[model samples]
Target: MINHPLECWLNLRMDRPLNSGSVSPEELQAWQFGLLRKTISHAVKSSPFYSKQLQGVVPDEILSPADLNKLPVTTPEDLRKNPNSFLCVSQDEVARAITLSSSGSSGTPKRLFFTSGDLERTTEFFQYGMGPLVGEGETVLALLPDSRPGGVGNLFAESISRLGAKTVYPEDPSDIPTILNLLLNSRASCLLGPAIHIHALARLWKSKRLPKNQVRSALLCWDLLPPVAIETISNTFGCEIFSHWGMTETCLGGAVECFQGSGMHLREPDFYLEIADPETGLPVPDGTSGEILFTTLSRRAMPLIRYKTGDLGQIISGPCTCGLSMRRLGDVKGRLDTDILLPTSEYLSMAELNEIILQYVGVLDFKVNYQQQSLALNIALDIAPESKIPTDLSRALTSYPKLSRTVLENNLKINIIIDNNDGSISSGFGKRLITSS
Candidate 1:
């Protein structure tokens, strides 16, 4: 008997032969220009925020890339300052109410509304992004906690249901043993979850000793997949790993990779992708890093065009042999503002730096502070002391050149603190891995 549950997905997805994922870059640009124009007009005509901002301005006449910037970049600040005013459509039409965390750098929360169509389009994203990886009747174990009103977990469940896969949702991230047992007995063929949860599972598997096979493919979504987590997953679980990059505000499925293991293939048709100089709001050529911008096309409740995502990445101009025409974003460099300033006249991204340093096991939690030329490391470990970091680490730390000379010349000191988070972990809301005070 075949598991035919995923037939619903076929009906929900595009009927066209998406098998060949490429549209010429020139074609994509033209298509995006039209969508951009439409989306801008929709926002200005419906959303009070845009209408007020576009006062004395016409979105329809705003053609050409140069005129696009004249509209202005809408920030989280704009939305929080006024939520009801940002409504693009009336309340009766809205089918769902989705609340999202504030995109602000600090405290306070923001709630946004989504119509039924808004939720459906988000689910459709999975058909293109993960449909290639998951086929009819496959079982997918979602390590994500199931919830709605906007989150990766709920959207993931919706996507899996569309693809006709069984979703064994874990109640929480800390519930490792219960989740592992379900995966063992339930015959889940594929796995998808936050990388941290998977990494924590890898740690538990090693400590408790459990069966590793049972999984055919795994997807790392929601958060950055640390390099260490990738190797541990492939080596221990022996399953293929595909990196997922998206934001809850943008919906769950923005991009995904095929089994080919190539770079992430963005979902371009649903949203326009952009990398621009943050300060100038001008497009940067492919391969040069800049802030990411997204424009939602199908959304009617809260349409956002050229909305700043706060994330940083660049496009992959070269072709992807995976046959996906949707553009690719470079292995993301975290938030544009999440920078560490070293006293050595250089800025550092703790996320980028730890992507290199967290290769070893037991480096459970780490925080790097480079203030006033001082590079201090706060590490939480399950094993391996400072002595195990290799004498070269000190020298390698010095190799930063500018930061190194200052430290060696008695201008600054590097502090390494080994604090055990006591195995506590969190997703979305709290601080973990790399964080600022």
Candidate 2:
């Protein structure tokens, strides 16, 4: 059997030859600890935030991964308050800076800086991560933004070229019709974009009765992969489905799902990940669900130590079915803050709403508003729907386990508004949220 592409890339990054053997977890952990110490020294001496945060702390004391728990964990608020204080390198050395808006009512946005070398590492990771899905001479239809020089889509396109593959992008990534035409015209074998946009395209394709000729695989990133989206895309396109988990702080490329489909392997050499109890901020045992935290091991512009990712996941214990020893992240759920509690003591999240609503054939996208015990949904369909669309959606949602109890006990009113004549509902990127008004 062929080795996992990421495993081979890890060996090469460590200066070991490819196809030799898998890098032992022990060896990788030791390498990470050494790098972590260096990162600590570098950040303490340069970065204002770390210098103040790590005052009276000694870098040499951090001899192993366990020592990381002793240090302070960074939060998104810290970055938003004073982003410049986190910069280790001079402003002249900063290659790119990405500003992420806060999901809540707060207007402050977190800014991340990256040096040229930092971007190179992410590009290198993308090159190897996509090895199993696309290769030389194959065309990849990248449905991500590429206008910025050091943007995620740009780096991904660069990685495709490095792998000797061709890349094509839609004129407007938000336009589903343009993307479908390009996918057919370019004869691209792989699709890479957010889950909702791809699902919309699949719905349109199915509505048009187009054949799934060239699309062999799809790489879903930048958003949650609701099970309904996966099933719809798979059934409509007859293509393999691949999921990726990453965020802006992670340089937009964290973990990629290998062919085995068990879980997503970490970018071990570049990052040290931890599963921590969200409430206590303490590390959890393997196979136990907790908040995802990661420390940068190879960062130069800005080194983050024990940064909270705001996402929940677990580490799958034992070797992968593909025979590699690298730790894999299990299914990651929604952010901790996304869940809303009802009077009936039931929880509802955008993920659950997505799983229930997107399953409908005509539904393209939906925006949710939950406030004062009233749940209102504005759903966008591919085409004009029958009069029964709203009623059908409401009945289906009330049947969901998470919402059933609340709906029955509280007499919850779920108002569904269907829009079939409008264009696409969402931009097809970024995290989805439930607005309270």
Candidate 3:
């Protein structure tokens, strides 16, 4: 019942006993080194960006993973300023081009080019990564766009079809009723989308007492999924919830979680991942929180070497209870630049705030802002009045030491506003904006 040739290819690959985790450290290092050498050679010869960046560095000199530090780290600024220079192939050879908007003040977007082979690799990853949640003959409802070629939704749909499953994508994700109708009519067993959108739908489905149909699992992709959001969605839907971690720069399908829920297992064969000190660019020990850096091993159109992802997280090295030996990625704690500064020079991360605010029972969504010597927390509620929300939120903030000090010293005042507008909350794609001012 294989629907795509790549499905067979993935099945055969997965059947191999010598997977990333099964191999000895020496064997894995040797394999990674070989791939690294090839990637370095390809990038230096084909990509103008790498050629100039790797001027005096020789590919053969990078005999081990640590040797990667010999080359300069590639930053988002490099991609923004000279994107085409990173392409290993000509424009005609590219199958798709994706533009990722920069998070900086300039607001410039970085364009990434992918060849047919690159797209196929992504499709293959999706087919296998999604294997645990979806089964043959089941329908998967994707709440992402399908209008454009190579969009995450389109690629996901194609992969689901390849796995011998049905996929339904609503014409417009903003239309919640239509989306819910499609899910119910299709009897979709699996749901995949950004965490925020899925959270909203889960609440609506619960409030309306909607029929669950065959829905069994949900995969929250694209952005960080706070623990509160996960618990809420899973409780509302009465299903297992999984998290996926990927970025446009890596062709989107990177790491995914298994049913055991230990952590998001790394796609070790296709991409080499490293946790590095953001300030020093030196590799950090496993279990240490730091920036995520990666090297593309198999991409043909564009090969990014030592590319800094700017994501903040640690790598876990213990054997997963799920029987996976591949290193797992810890829960992403938001970006390095997403820290909120206080008047006392103390810091609060958006991830931390999200964990606290999302725990409040009637809180649907929220945003934070600092202005006029006060910190305002705008919240979207599933309930009315919103009078007790500010007091409730203030009490919650007291649980955090740094926030409590800020409040006690009167260095900052806490304010809460009820915002029903969709614009105030995130649209469930890209990075969540934590502060407006």
Candidate 4:
């Protein structure tokens, strides 16, 4: 079997002899454990927060991966409280500081600081991660913001250039028509953006009667990739759909999928990933869904030890045909903070609703509101309002097993309001959530 592109990239980074063959899973685990201990010692000696938080702990004592349970997990609140405390480097050494507002009701924002070396490492990861998406000399049009000096899109553009591929960006990512025209004119081989934006462009492409096969593939990131969105893009553009899992903390390049599409292989050399019981904070067995946590192995400016991501995921079990031994992370289900609790204590995840609702035709995007035993859906359709779409969408809502049970037992009323606009109303580049209107 051929080695996965990421595994090949890792070999280059480790400088292993080409004749030595691919690294085994056991070797990767040992390398990660060794680096974890080294990183812990560095963090304890440098970062103020880690020094006090891990006061009594000895880094040398953490000999195995399981020993990480002895350390306390870091939360978003901790970072928001004092980001400077997590800094391991002096202020002069820092290259970029990004302030990200909280997605939840917490008005305070958390800031992440990265040195030039850190940003360079992320750019390298992005370079290798794009192996499965585009080939040399191909053009990748990113429908993402690139104005910032070291933003995610900027880093992606840099990485694509390093890969010997061309990168193009629309004048305004929010303008759907501009993106469509750029795709038609540029004839870019790849499309990279949020899942919804790509889906909307595909919907518009189909509605406009444009030619298909302009894009050979797409790399969807910055948000969850719904199956419905994948099917729509694949059908409309005749392109392969690839999804990536990462966040601001991971420098936006954590895990990526190969052509096999089994799961997203982790950036094991840089990040040591773990899945723990969401409530108990204990490591769960592989394949068990739980909160995702990771410890940085190669961070210099700010090292997050046992950081709780608040996103639900699991480590995939079984061997992949791609011949990579690195652990792969399953699709991230949803955020713990975004799950809406119903009257009966049952929870409805936004991912579940998106899977069912986004599959319907003419349904571009929708905002969910639940209050006082009433569930109102403010839906935006690409096509003009049809008399039957609202009823059909309402029926799809109650079809979920958990939701159907909750509605009947709690007398939940369903309301559907079809917005007359062209799906641009809910096209913001943020995580979709249920709001109380």
Candidate 5:
């Protein structure tokens, strides 16, 4: 738990009007229902897409969260098909436009628009979300893109500046020596970037044998931070590592981890989150893994009603030790589209594979390749030459009854190749694809 006085002081300073975590669930629901009605009315009247999507459904009819399912889901394909139809504001009124191509997409990319007020709300969320880790007089080194106006990096810098802190955004983050110099010279207290990039820098810092413990804290975004990666980074920098979950659709500001680090505290005041069956789109019981569906309650430019995020996770209820009443979300368990299919048609989630692989000693990184009648696991090990595959790992894999039976009944070939060269494993900004032909 965080220090009580400090948390209170930061909360007061941030002056967040919707710290719904501090209120009762009933109160939060009432607040959310009111916002939902208003958002629905606005979107239907302004956005051609929502106007057609919500045909015959009165905004007032959605009095409860469950009734929200009466509306159809807005999918990425829908956004890509005709993005202009989703816009509530005119093109001239748009403050920022972002084009993103989803993995495996070959057609037109999905476009998202945000007004100046929308961007300001995201910045405000960042300001409040980061208050616990960042404070006055500290320098935050942002390793995200900051050149474009109204981009995520620029908004992040603005938010830090609003909190009376200086920000350092590298023009080219690939240049390691330059970033090291900036970190050393500026005496930066907080480091924020994708997990892969931050891990790479930490390894580079260790390889150079630089002075120890320069950074005070680190916030990793964009990708999931494996336990080993978090441990290595924290050890290298001698700082606590935090994680945040969001997407471009949400303007890049969403749930964040408090000092407790149990789970990500949801930004319920701005968005209402629900866990639903990926196939049926019906709400699932709390703590049950399901697809994450969210509704934009405050967004003006492109308000989404029950948007299917494709990401997988569960909603955690109960009070947090940090004293925040907001609900939390479990660690994202990869995407639904990326699940690996077996010969027997059984699906293996990447999160399950990650949990098993990261526990082995001397394992640095790994990639999974699915080919004709075979599953190849290419692993990068930290061990020296002559070290063979651990017997314990073989036993652990076979111990999982489902996997063991599938491997035997289907006669599926499982090959494990251990490579000592860490460079063989590649990292990306978002979900890393493990499947290959």
Candidate 6:
């Protein structure tokens, strides 16, 4: 492989190939297929679940996007019904066990096992993915949720320690105020956590005149980040902010954003990524939005092939300014389940709702639940004591049209619950439950 100076720089920052500023699309595709074949063959042989599923089938049978459909999609139910079936190693070989819920209200919890090698791979991803947006000797306070024994957080804590970064979790709501002070004086170079928790910190900084850029960067995940919030965070932190994509079932990440600011690069070497039709299991053309379908490339204890991520994104094949041979995803559009349908026949997604609420800046947090037939939109939010609802804000709803039309064209109503805290919002988990019945 030719060592372009730019390529070397990106490689140093990222463990996987990226849009390193001048990667050829053809070369990238070839690299993808080669890695895909090897990962599939290895998983099928070692993973108990995959071995039984692919029994009597040739690894070559999964030749293309279409051929993948011939194999059944993996569901959490399969794991719950027979958890041990996914094991690829014997009892003596298994090094760790982690239990996690799929985040689905109806899904059961799952246990995933990892050998030392799996942890090593995840550790490398952190060094490569988060390292670029970061500088050495900076302290990172992990706002990420504590994944108690055998959960994702435990792994993240281990990873953070490996990165030579210190971690801080509020652990209790009472600690938030104290956490705020530590961030101020700790001269902490980084703050890493979910968008909601980190955003609350930004609001606190906005009001308290806390030191900015004394912090190096913020690593955010777990919820849809509103564009307005991103701008506000960068301004308040006075430093770079980066985000990576991950899923509980897929072992942390599907991709990570680069310093280029173009889009997140798919960790193609670690996972076989494809955008597929949710109903038909067929590949969507590059650059078109569809469900994200993934196959684990780096797996030992458990390997999932052609797993439906339930996340939507676009695949880019054209040239990238940052330049790595691997593919880049246009964006991860949140869960397919976030969409809510009204009797007026309009559809609303959590992303759209977040954009609307954050635009006001007057709001801090809220709980939303749809009413029968969508006659009313009830919004619970924190607002200012002196401020009152602006009629124009209601009018802006139609700008998005489909959702706004329910109130505009139909008899639908909007009831906003604003508990104005003078700009301070409560800290909690699970997306603030914007929509509830």
CA lDDT of every candidate: 0.64, 0.81, 0.74, 0.79, 0.73, 0.65
lDDT of 1 by residue, 268-313 (tens): 6667777889888898888898988887766788877678877877
lDDT of 2 by residue, 149-209 (tens): 5575688889999989988987677677777788888889898889888888888788779
Descending-lDDT candidate ranking: 2, 4, 3, 5, 6, 1
lDDT of each residue in 135-225, candidate 5, tens digit only: 8999998877443565756998898888899888766665544666778788998999876566656765665677666787899887666
Local error of candidate 5 at residue 214 (angstroms): 2.1
What TM-score fits each model? 0.82, 0.94, 0.88, 0.93, 0.82, 0.83
Q: What's the lDDT for candidate 5?
A: 0.73
Highest-lDDT candidate: 2
Q: What C-alpha lDDT does candidate 3 achieve relative to the native structure? A: 0.74
* Pairs with backbone N, CA or C atoms under 3 Å apart (clashes), candidate 2: none
Position 353, candidate 6: lDDT: 75
Among the numbered candidates, top TM-score falls to 2
Deviation in Å, model 3, residue 408 alpha carbon: 3.0
Q: Model 5, residue 412: what's the lDDT?
A: 54
lDDT of 1 at 379: 36
Candidate ordering by TM-score (highest first): 2, 4, 3, 6, 5, 1
Per-residue lDDT, model 3, residue 351, is 75
As a whole number from 0 to 100, the lDDT of residue 34 in candidate 1 is 76
CA deviation > 4 Å runs, candidate 1: 1-22, 62-67, 102-105, 145-152, 175-178, 209-212, 352-357, 367-377, 381-423, 426-437
Cα miss at 437, model 6 (Å)?
3.1
Question: Which ranges of candidate 2 are over 4 A from the true structure?
Answer: 145-147, 373-391, 420-423
